[model samples]
Target: MGSRNSDRIPIQMRRRKCETVADMAAQGWDVLSKCQACGLVMRVNLKMIAKVSGPATSLWNRKQRCRRVGCTGFIEFQGRAPDMHWHETLAAPSDGEM
Candidate 1:
């Protein structure tokens, strides 16, 4: 039984890999937005970009609210930046953790 389960593990892993590849293919370039006030950038992964936009927008809105008495117009859109490969490297799961 243990050997049988072990054999199934590779099959399961292959399925997961195929699913991830399909998801990656379905998602093209991601659209990102930035807040001018705090220079906070929100990266929207295209797979579920629309679903996540509200939270990202809310974060920017909350950041715009000034606790200080003299501040006004705290939030503005700064625009997008080119996606960086370093981010992918950082996001990859470490072998040790796996």
Candidate 2:
């Protein structure tokens, strides 16, 4: 017999792993995320680490936010050093808004 839907996988396992903004920048990656609840998109600047974390900004973590007028979406960013150019997009669902 096959496993039930609820038993197939844990809810946490189905969710994508969250990464810090700094991690993305270090890997030469920038994130363009949009809110699933609203059609709000934001560009997270991982490059801002130099202003706070020093020259080796790639080793630091930065905070990111959604620019939507009333959106309270936020994400943690800890960019990693990458050998090639990288860009990523993510979808955020406002907590309690869904």
In order, candidate lDDTs are 0.32, 0.41
Top-lDDT structure, candidate number: 2
**Tens digit of lDDT per residue, candidate 2, span 1-98?**
56345333332231232234444554465455455456465554656645566544421223356566786766443221232133222323335221
RMSD of each: 14.7, 10.9
Model 1 off-target regions past 4 Å?
Answer: 1-27, 50-98
Q: Which ten residues in a row have the lowest lDDT in candidate 2?
A: 10-19
Instruction: Give the true-structure RMSD of model 2.
Output: 10.9
Query: Tens digits of per-residue lDDT for model 1 on 21-47?
Result: 224324342334444455445554544
**Clashing residue pair totals per candidate (backbone < 3 A):** 0, 14
Residue 5 displacement (Å), model 2: 31
On TM-score, the candidate that comes out on top is 2
